[model samples]
Target: MKLRVFNIIKNTKVEGPGNRYCIWVQGCSRHCRGCQAVHTWSHKGGELYDVEVILDDIFNQKDKIEGVTFLGGEPFEQAEALGIIAQKVKEKGLSVLCFTGGKLEELRENQINKKLLDNTDLLIDGKFIEKLTDYSRPWCGSSNQRYHFLTDRYNEEIFTKYKNKVEVNISKNGQIFMNGMGNFDEILRKVDLMGIK
Candidate 1:
């Protein structure tokens, strides 16, 4: 159940809604021009850990985090493993968000990717288009990419429930951040409880 992961950010604000634990899986052949995780492009560059161990850590931080974010070296490449992890996170009552180089439609067609997205709350998808680069967007590196609300089909009611509540941010300096569905005070409280730096 273990997967190769380039890195793990126990507490991050810009990755997903609220303070989230971001898992950066290793391996991506898509090498977009401005790829931030250049080091993760190689499939053989990461360390492996059991899914249970990663899940345990995330669940244990529930009281201190609003959700979990999956980043990549193309998470969909290990969609099966991602699905396993997502299911466990869902059981913990925390939402899941993912970053990918694949289009939502393309991923939806893949059984494994769909399984992972079944429990995903949001997806920031599309490869980095250097020509369409825009730093103003939330959770996306380039303007060509989009933020897709996959939870419950991006409907009105669902939108209202999550609207303004969940926000992921990326600083100009490449610092990732997330503001959970709850307010800033709640996020700060969770951060304090987690003893996160």
Candidate 2:
């Protein structure tokens, strides 16, 4: 299966428990208000790659990462392709963490989600609600989102072990990309005031 990918970070800590390989799949139908990733909403915008190729890349980084994380445009939109990668990764003894804007019950109703859910160690669900925005918890940006421990890999300890944070990545060409969850607007505002060169 081929997956439309918006971006990939070979390793990042703030995205989940321990270091993780994060894949931001392309396209989202939710378009929730105040979404920071409008750039990922276009279904046709990102490059396509075979699931095997993605699995290869994940394996290459397996030694350094604790697991893989699927966040998106909407990971469930490309569930089957991601499921292939997730199941393979789990077989390798690495965990899988997935984020979706839809609730768990709603997702469970879809037969295509079986493989993905079965393989995902941690699943974060629910759309971002602007008014209910709260960053106290780890990873999830809004209060409406809930975390599900589908496997024994992770549990409620995450609440005490982690907190909302962001990682700043600057590529060789000077492109700055930020990931993870928090109040980005305020963070950027503070950065602007500092005027760092």
Q: Provide TM-scores for the models.
A: 0.77, 0.97
- Give residue 46's error in model 1 in angstroms: 1.1
Which lDDT value does model 2 have at 119? 98
For 1-197, candidate 2 gives per-residue lDDT tens digits of 79999999999998999999999999999999988899999999999999999999999998999999999899999999998999999999999999999999999999999999999999999999899998999998888899999988899999999988898776788676889998887877876687731
* TM-score (C-alpha) between model 2 and the true structure: 0.97
Can you give the lDDT of residue 42 in candidate 2? 95
lDDT of 1 by residue, 1-197 (tens): 88899888788776655688989999998999867567889988999989989998888788888888988889999889889999889887888888889899988887777779888888888998777765554555567877777775333343333323444455688564553322444665776687651
lDDT of 2 at 10: 96
Q: How accurate is candidate 1 locally (lDDT)?
A: 0.77
Separate clash counts for every candidate: 7, 0
Error of 2 at 179 (Å): 0.7
Off by over 4 Å in 2: none
RMSD of each: 8.2, 1.1
* Colliding residue pairs in candidate 1: 13-177, 13-178, 14-176, 14-177, 14-178, 18-179, 18-180
Stretches of candidate 1 off by over 4 Å are 152-197
